[model samples]
Target chain A: MNSVLDIAFTSNIKRVWHPVFRQFGLLALVLPGASLFLIPWLWMLSTAGKDTALIWKTPPVWIPPVYHWDNFIKAWLQGDFAVYYLNTFYISGMNVIGILISSVLAAYAFARIRFPGRDILFIVVLSTMMLPRQVTLIPLYMIFSELGWINTFKPLIVPLFFGDAFSIFLLRQFFLTISRELDDAALIDGCRRLGVLFRILLPLTKPALAVVAIFNFTWAWNEFFTPLIYLDSPKLFPITLGLHRFIGRAQIDIQFLMAMTIVSTLIPIGIFFLTQRYFIQGIVITGIKG
Target chain B: MAARSSLADFVKRRFTQRTEDILTAYLCLLPWIIGFLAFTLGPLVFSLVLSFFQADLFTRNIFVGFGNYIDLVQDPLFLKSLRITAVYAFVSVPLGAATALAVALLLNQKVVGLGVWRTVYYLPSVISGVAVAVLWMQIFNPRMGLINNALKVVGIEGPSWIFDSTWALPSLIIMSLWAVGANMLLYLAGLQGIPTHLYEAAKIDGANVGRRFWHVTIPMLSPTIFFNVVISLIAAFQFFTQSFIMTNGGPNNSTLSMVLFLYRKAFQQTRFGYASAVAWVLFAIIICFTLLFIRSSSLWVYYAGEERDE
Candidate 1:
């Protein structure tokens, strides 16, 4: 038995250490995926730190001699990204709160309550998820125009107060997984339905709520279409729309643009890195069921 | 005391209980109901109505009753946009899904610093679409872009990727592949869900790694593959941000997508009714394609813990 165990272990090592296997083992797998995914960002970072001359040089410098940390400062200042950041944060923050409040209420009802036409109404809400926002763009614009809401943040933020189908759907799925006995107990404790939702379910569903918040934050921050359509003032533009002004028709400053691009992406990437565990779990469950 | 109460009193109490139940349900549903009516349902119905008319910026909609749809069918540019969208969807969806699956398969392997690699791969997924477009525009710059320089080192010259008509769509497709992290994460979940016993059984049967992957892994992962395909197809059809930012559908509308064209018509040209018609047509196309995919999925999508009909 000892010899057999020894042989098995040695053979495993030999198999792993085989020249062909070892040559292609980890490096081969990591390289192609990494290059495909990482090289562009590295290029963006490297170029953003280079001067114009170095940027335009033949054979291009993959790495700059000195990192121009000030380029980020310059990009931030000159691009008026300070204002963009403020506007973006304000809008995204409001939108997240709005989504959470309205979606939680709606999702709780869908998950816990029995009502006439409940299934049909839920299906109607879910069906809206299938309709691309583009399909409704023109009509929505017309409505906003009639209301004189264009060029204002109203168009961007107001609709968010109305529960989004995707958000509600996700939150409802989370709510459904929770036991009903908790709600019954809350009712016996003199808690109203709304009170139960706030005190009992919301606390238990922190991960789901976090997922919703993170999703909303990133999406709202990166949202370009609505901002571009509704916002006419450059001061009101988000980082996404503001960044486009740098890439004009005739010529583009490659380094400056890359620098600005890298800077703009940092916030969302940072948020994702911070909350990735919840985000991944959310995606897995949602995508599989959806 | 209950025996002494009149029948009318008990009936009145029951009526009140029913009304309370109804009121409670409506109260809970108020936000979604109002939103659905004002935002979603309202706009949808309005679009359906407006698609039958022609409206300028200031005038009342002139009823044309399918005129815009007819024009869409006849317009060469609309046809071109539709074809472009179809091609974009077909190419990008498959490419994105394949890359995602490949990366997920790699990440599923027992490796060091797995978390770091996962984060690295996911970084692009979180980056703003406009930022990615701008970044890639520079990277694909014909002269000094890293891609071109790399090609020059190999004694080959890279084409102007964004500017060249032939390369613009493909450039966007390549850019889409950069954000495969979301799908990769989905695939990872799918991979982990596959029972390990299957692989072990295959190994004991003297099946090579390739055979095990084909017979065991691929079949188990088909549902995820199907899901990715459908979602990616839907997204690719509405491809707008990259083209709008990078190319502005430029160089003779080479990169003009269905959504971008709709945007141009509605926002730029101020033909709201016409754009509505175009949008409806797009919706129909998407529905048809989605239904087709869903119908076809039964042939391939395998659900665990379900009996196969055949």
Candidate 2:
């Protein structure tokens, strides 16, 4: 929550005599670097709207002569992106609900309840985070195939309902920050444990919940590996898979590829901009307190 | 001591409370426990067992008992993939951390439109996926690509990145650095948390800027740096998506990451047992490095208010 100007150890007395000089110097260095960071995005925007002839033009054009915005329409139509978008939304929606419910309940218990073997259970949860998902891919694939869940959203969405390690850990940290007195007072007023959670705790942790939701949504939206393995049907492919398939099939059209890439990036970028404050706060809390 | 006794008292009063705290806790944890058993723990143990047998999707699983693992050691492709991943992980972890820390240091200084700058720098990392991979693949194109075109202006001919074996792995490493903003943000957060008084104190003690940075800023920031490094290391080891999308272990399998190799084995070739063995090897390598990091962190990572046992 610290303001940008509230930075520690930035101000040096030696440079205090010429504050204006220092500011300009910092600006001179930073502006170009910031622009450098933004080049790929600007390039993406430029490329997505360019004419096919200009795509191969040597000394690549910075600005397209005529902005062919229909490339977006063309890419969408050609790639079956509507279906991919719908499938991605469905999967992301299911996962967000699943993670929020399971993580909130588990996090609340870990944060507030004094129960036997709580420490060991929490350790197991933490250990799961470190264990690479690759190690479990084969068996999980087998299990899903055995249950006839392959090529369905079930393999993609069901496991998240049990909750994920990182989300549970993040929510638990946020929950621990709330005072125990709030829970105690609510309990004293005949608010049951679940009631206390719903009425008292949930409201205070909305920011954390939003953070978890945004993260899960983005992760599910951009997810490729699981979708690639589980869902073979093009109809079931999410944005990432759909885009990959599109790229593979239409290797000749650079403009369409760029347009499709933009389409795939749009939702997550929109979410990031809208929920930026909460996103930064979530990362800071996890980095410092984790 | 008081907290422990209070916890003990709370447990003693458990019977007086109509709702069993333990039962409620268990109820709350039921979903995660089930998930752990079914998805994570079960698959983990199953995969370990799977590594021992020779099983294709259609054939009966034969008990080979370390035969798959022995083959993994001798397999040139597995060894090549491991080495590629190791190099990528090792190089990227330090390179990424240093670049991020540098950017964070610059960004920490009071500048106009700080929020915009942060957003600009961070957008790439946030939007990472197939889109990113595709974008970079285009950017690294030797002919008429942004990079080579830019280099052409300077009269330097650029190599065909991601297409030449010599440059393919390096191309992936370079692409990896594009997402340094995640760690940069972490460093910025860590920097803001340091007490200004420490800087003033260091200045009063006649420490110059370089001395202050080395002695105070670094020590204070060590824990954050350590955390970033470990997470980055772990992530780099499992690096995929981009290579899968961009290179597909191409240009003579030069960019074949361990996970990509595992994926090819499992999905493409249907070598389930061999892939499972590769997975276990990757797991072992990751664990060893993580343990090494944790062990070495004691010597360098500084936590305020924590006393060294020595």
Candidate 3:
């Protein structure tokens, strides 16, 4: 590989003098790739900053005349984003706690405990990954309605308490990677199973826990379908559903809508950045090794 | 002393040991077992039963014995939804997978600011789906949209993307390709796993960059590609959000996906039985496709650890 690197370096140096070929090749790959992802976001930012008349102008101004920072405040007030933020935070927080507890306990069982039919049960759990949520939606809705849990946060929070297959799988993979010697030592020390989980496993698996937290938070935050179907009142609406209301109420106000969109999107990205060290480590460790 | 023990004592000890093991294991599994029974198995069986009956919002279900499936086979809307879903799946999965692989290959080059570039590409995938859809709706607006204005600058007229029946599904496909970051990350992992010695040997044999890529890089990355393809296909078949948010299956039902149609039938029209049937059919189709892919994977998926048969 080092030799290949040397040869590739020489070849690249020789090829660089051919400016036209180099530029074309580089531009062909990089330009389209970057523009495909970036241009729309740039357009969103620019449009959000523009005034109403300028937004509709021909040859659509790539830059706004003056940065309308008020669009953010206006969108915040008009969209009732403060309420949406609180609602989203509350639901997502509850969901995160629910998923973490359920997933960790389930993962510990699958990873550490031995019992008859364990493998069969694990397979049953994994098989649910293939079953699309659409298949379960109608019947689940009926069950919820019968229980009179509709139009409440119960439908949203209760499912997470039962455990999610993906989160369980991820945490199990992390657990399996840990050394069994530690568990044996804990056992010799007369630690009960639950004590081992809390005192030993939980402390060592912070990366996995962080991954679960971030994943649950993001999924709960961005979830649209269930929240859209379950929650009827605007006061209970998450940011995702709240943004939809903005479009529904003022479809023509592109500037205001884009501003609200940006505002709503910022928190998740911020969360990702803050927890990213553990997130990437979690993925590379659990996903690849498993 | 143990051998001299009475049969009652031995039997009692064995029974206690058995009970202790079972109790400990079951205690560990208690939460997941309860969850599986409640959320997964219960709903699964309920959906299966519901598919066979006719029900409305205000009344109990009437068992009709496959009547919903029969109605579905004869229904034009169901057929249209299936066709639309098939096209959406076939087009988007391959396109998204190919784009992700290509971007991954390009970024795999020893380039400066690679981390920054990776983050920029991944930003859209992390953005709220509603926010992305709403933003793209503005970008794809018929007259005053950014896309049209950009096209007009180059003397080309852009179509009314979401409003035009001809362009609506394609417009969603275009929007979906923006979030190729997840697959890109997967591919990057795959790329990193390729052994460096092979590339070294290829260089010693005077293989050029393109040749090395085709012969070495591609063969090594096939498994990751396969994984991405199957997963992406499954996801695309259930496509709902873009159509739900942007087109709402409008302009003559150009984008009435299977999932979207199911949602409308169940929620909007309150036809729970027929919607449940549609959901089952979609699930069956997804399973069939996945099985087919799994069957075919042995032909192309190169397992690094497997020994070749002589």
Candidate 4:
């Protein structure tokens, strides 16, 4: 991996300036452009620490004269982010568990089980990934409404229990790569198909499981459209909904809004930074296989 | 008679075992099957049926026989939203693909802190959804935003983004550039997969950097590029949250997207039938574009497994 990633014509660098100079030359090309990408985040952090008057400054105060430490607290209280945070955590947590159980089960079957029509069934599952969610949105909304699940967390969390097309695809691809000898070895010990999955395959696929957990959680955390449509009441709203609703008042309440935005994004960003490898690996596996 | 009876019993036992294996497989697939039937297939079939009826919150659903779709043809708002969505998809797909490839190429350069640069560039996708929309709203604020403030630094007046009808769509396009990180990562992986020996061979031919990129890098990465185009196109057509949260399809409805239009029709106006029809239209457009993209791939997309130009 380290070797193939080096594509630059580096022989020229040895003939030119010092080795350190070459590093600086590459950084000079990359750093300026990268800083621009980081600006919105940095700019938001700056505003979160400033007064409303300073936020509107033409030259823009890169650093606030007064570090508003209380802005986070103020935003936390005013936005009622405690309940929103709890709601988001509950929804995302249940969503991840649901996705894991269903996807792992289905992926194991698809990868290992050699039943009649298995290939056709697997293709059907894969094809669902391409179906536009919008096509089904109206009917799903109406169905939940009829079941009296609207304005509640049921609509948001229940669908995940059935599994997602992408997660199933991801896990299935990972499962296919594992040697089938492990499953056969387990089965010879008087284990059933389910036992083989639990005792051998599931334990072996931890990295893939981690990948699913990360993707499902991040997706649930950042989800907006579904919650936007279903969860009408503020009490049940996730942070995304809360932040969106608060934007109307963002003009008048600039300080707290910036602080709230910063707090809301912290978890997914943290997860991303922490688990960068599994996340990128998941993408590569999916991209190549799919 | 005894020999025939033994043969029949043996066949019966084998059939039962096979049935059991098949049953176990299905039991494993039960969640997906049930979910598909209840959640996916049911809704799709229901939506199709609903599109032919006069369904709403106020009145009982009345079968109207393609009335909603016919109404779609004449409805000016539908046409307007369709046009806006079409334009957004056309511009953003290519721009997003090009920028993503560029970022991939830049990051592909062998350097120290490569991981750090990759992470920083991907930062925007991490903090996305409504947070991203709200963040950009402030950044594009005409009088006080960072973009205009920077423009003011150079003594050129900045356009009123997201508020002006002319610039609202374009502003959304600019903001869309921020989330190209995931696609970039895929391209980065594609870059890695291309054996370095290809580059050594290119250099042996005395290919310059520009020629190497055009002849080697682009062709090698064409499969990834093709994937990006299709994925970006499907996503771009479903442009909702940015316009929905930031502009609400406002400033003379210049930024009114198809999904947002469908949402309003169903929820706000209680025109479920109309909304269902609009969604079918969106789905059809996506299918057409996807097919077109696949058809065009043979002309440009180069599979590494196939014969290469000698």
Candidate number with greatest DockQ = 1
lDDT of candidate 4 over A30-127, digit per residue (tens): 88879888999888999889987887787889989889989899879887799899999999999999999898889888888889888888788877
Query: What is the C-alpha lDDT profile of model 2 across B1-310, one tens digit per residue?
Result: 9999989987776665535667788899999999999999999999999999998778899999999989988989989999999999999889999989988888888777789888888888887478889999999989868889989999999999999999989988988888898899999999999999999999999999999889998999999999899889988999888788888888899989999999989998988988999999999998999999999988999989964221
Q: How does model 4 fare in lDDT?
A: 0.88
Tens digits of per-residue lDDT, candidate 3, B210-300, equal 9999989988888788877877888899988889999999778999999989998899999988898998999999999999998998888
* lDDT score for residue B73 of model 1: 91
The docking category that best describes candidate 4 is medium
Worst 10 residues of 4 chain A by lDDT: A1-10
Worst window of 10 by summed lDDT in candidate 1 chain B: B301-310
Off by over 4 Å in 4: A1-21, B1-17, B306-310
Q: RMSD, each candidate, Å?
A: 3.5, 5.6, 4.4, 4.9
Interface RMSD of 4: 2.8
Q: Once model 3 is optimally superposed onto the true structure by TM-score, how far is the C-alpha of residue A139 displaced, in angstroms?
A: 1.5
- Which regions of candidate 3 are displaced past 4 Å? A1-28, A250-252, A283-290, B1-22, B205-207, B306-310
- The CAPRI classification for model 3 reads as medium
Query: Which tens-of-lDDT digit does each residue in A237-288 have in candidate 3?
Result: 9999999988889454778898899999888889878876665565555445
Residue A290 in model 1: shift from native, Å? 2.5
lDDT of 2 at B241: 89
- Candidate 3: what lDDT? 0.84
Scored by lDDT, the top model is 2
Model 2 chain B is weakest, by summed lDDT over 10 consecutive residues, at B12-21
Report per-candidate DockQ.
0.60, 0.56, 0.51, 0.53
